[model samples]
Target chain A: MNTLGISVDAWAAWAPGIDSPNDWNAWLAGDSCLDEGVKPNVSFVPPMYRRRLSLLGKMAVLTAQQCVDQYPIDSSLRLVFASRYGENARTVGILNNIVDDGSVSPAAFSLSVHNAIAGIFSIIHNATEPSVSVSAGQETFSAAWIEAEQILWSQMENADRVLLVYYDEPLTGDLTRFTDDIQIPFSISLMLSKSQSNGESICLQNKRALDSSDSSLNESKLNQPLSFLRLLLSPEQMISTTTSNWVWVKNSANA
Target chain B: MSDLIQEIKELIIEVLDLEDISPDEIVATEPLFVEGLGLDSIDALELGLALKNKYNVSIDAESEETKKHFSSVESLAAFVTSSR
Candidate 1:
């Protein structure tokens, strides 16, 4: 089977609500909170492309643009976007209006779909590339990454490359409190190529889930994105049997 | 007239998440883009939605003239007042 090596091209994160680790630590203790300056508004985004976008849309596009700028790729490359909760803010906002005022904003209604981010990306980038968005609840992280790897692996038979972008922002209101216990706002993109790695390579190792009483699987308190992130980006000393997201396979420097 | 501009300035500050900007510092004719306020395209989209929600003004974003209206908070307020 043909395998593809993936490397991190660019990652950008913007967290609106929390300003410090102390605030984030408080969130881990299960607190329904709001960050004073975390809300996404239009002034932060530029004017030429600001005519059509939501808060979530802005974040996704910015991260994707960052990736494109960092690594110049063919506009025809395939892409995969994954997000858990998938536009829950727009969902709840529409639901609130329907229940209270019997009306919904047209933009909000359209953006409520799961593929909205992918669609927006295709437009802003002016790329007619094939793309798909995925939402698999708690299994979102593993499923999305695995799918991207599989796509790259398949393309490697023809020596093709693909980009995988993973992004998720916590929803506003009380629901965020019930969900992510940490304020881990992040967006990570991995550009997978049939070519060999330069030095830092990320390897996706598949292993059987052991029968154990792990708090992550059982408790709703664990934030999957943050948990997976810590393990994925952890240093060698930080590696522990307790965490198993993915192992980084390091080899040579590009230079 | 200054009061209306001040009010619009406050609205811009609130909607755009401008942490350090004060209403008094925003001049009426200063550019709101790269030169003055340094807002980008994404901020325009979000703040446009916010303006619609707050003032009940119909922002025909599909039109090209909307660019001139967003040049400054003064123009935006004037546009809103005239449109109403």
Candidate 2:
């Protein structure tokens, strides 16, 4: 496919010990690292609904809130929430409960679904527009971006913006044996629009022409979201991230 | 009976994740669901599970009596006592 053009109207990210832009810049410079066992404070959410959100959900919602705060969208906003392994900790607890006594906490079960965070966000914002939840293995972020891009491309008249959120946490228990991706609990939210006139223009191209065996290409230790965040925060012209099947090249339009 | 009421109040605070509310602040006679604590139906279900796990009490989710038992800390304490 040709390089699909898009613009980032606003962005926000959160992880333990890394919240502000300065923190992210320091992290990219290898001067700081994400602290373990620290959770994002989402006190803005009312107590009643906040109780239902898992740590991952809190990260997603918090970043999205911060992004919107930076650039408020007055037009209809569509949301695309992406997570590779969403709420696995909560789901594991529910499964253990079922095995132990054939009973589960109703609230835990309710919030364990993949789309539960998206549901919570829609309810909290009273956003009646269409929303989608996605999980696509290693290519989850790229998939979500493509989904957001498609939404903007197809529904430009009805909706001018889409909030793309990606969040995940380290796998626990036996589930840790599944993959070797970075285990940090982090979230990135980007407000994307089709209008190229405003904000930072970027393009995503599927790297089919590039040789898959190129020795110069290095795999990033950080996961896709963090890698993309590094690219966004840095002055780099382009960064290539490889998933299981596809290599995605993100380029700054200015470069 | 008051000890059981306090225990249930703490349990409610713990199970429902009422982080800001202290046990002493929860009036035993006040409604636990909407109009008082403002908890919705999901809280009721979660509280029922906690009660079942802690007190081994069977809650008929659809029964009017279950609603009565879940109305307040006092009512839940009475239900647990009777069940035991």
Candidate 3:
């Protein structure tokens, strides 16, 4: 068993296929999935970063806020953002400006990169700790987990905790051709600390694949972040003995 | 003057998604920002774009007078009328 495990977790997603799941109960139930004709209302959102952020950034920021509420961790906690496609629509808008109009908005061009979400997360949360954004195709899942584990290891030595977030949205237009296999807007956040409790805790081994019954479980079984979040919230699925996954809360303060 | 300001008020309400506030509720002398409708910097920028596209008013962010022009729907309408 890995010495450390995930502690608290939260998730959010855009599942046009499902209604009534926007509430917290449906999220915990893991019933969110995407279909079509579903778009988030950006108006009701706060106005601080609304001007600079697109729809994706708004969703990411909202999800991150929910995660902070769920875990109630310290503001000093570090954050990690993982995505398979980073601001693809924003990229298209800038590229189209350069190609069709011969001009691009400098602000839009700057935010089009993959790390924009991470940067926004830091600014929104007012965090200054070291944070990283990772993109690794299909291996994004394993790669992010490993990176989080490494950070946790270092933080543990210093006697601290870490926050990790995994999020991905569907690409629009031509970009969809490259990443249509998983079709759901999803984001998941996990808060890790050195604690153990009645909560499920399991050690993770081979990052390759979960070959047991857990392996058969669809990662995208539900909406992107919501599906993984359901697993985290569910006490029943907290510890996957068949696979190398676990979550435990320890009372001991010492790392 | 009243008709122009009223029309601009409606446009501002629509463009900014001010569901809670009606155009009629906005007073000509009241501030449209923190003191009145609680609009923030983002809303100001969006309103700036909509106004530029709808009217021929040119706004440069570097100018202090532009901020005063957008302080209220009345001022914006007056500015638009004068510039037009």
Off by over 4 Å in 2: A73-75, A197-199, A209-221, A244-255
Error of 2 at A202 (Å): 1.6
By summed lDDT, which 10 consecutive residues of candidate 3 chain A come out lowest? Answer: A242-251
Q: Quote the positional error of residue A219 for candidate 1 in Å.
A: 14
Instruction: For candidate 3, list the clashing residue pairs, or say none.
Output: A186-A225, A187-A225, A195-A249, A195-A250, A196-A249, A196-A250, A197-A249, A200-A247, A201-A247, A202-A246
Which wins on lDDT, candidate 1 or candidate 2? 2
lDDT (Cα, tens digit) per residue for candidate 2, span B1-84: 999999998999999999889998898999989978888888888888888889999989889889888888899899999999
lDDT by residue for model 3 (A1-255), tens: 335554443444443444233444464455444445665544544554455566567666655666677665464466777877778887877777678857555456667888887786676666777788888765565567667667766735352556666766778776777763455665555665544555543334443433355533433334333434455444433222222232222222323
- The model with the greatest lDDT is 2
Across residues B1-84, which tens digit of lDDT does each residue of candidate 1 receive? Answer: 677788889987776656567898888899998788777675677668777777778888788889899999889889878877
- Candidate 1 lDDT over residue span A120-190, tens digit each: 67766667777888887666765776776677667343325566666676677657666734344545555
Score every model by TM-score: 0.57, 0.90, 0.63
Clashes within 3 Å, all models in order:
17, 0, 10
Candidate 3 structure quality by residue, lDDT tens digits, B1-84:
998988898888776766556777888878988888777675777688677778868889889999899898889988999988
Ranking by DockQ: 2, 3, 1
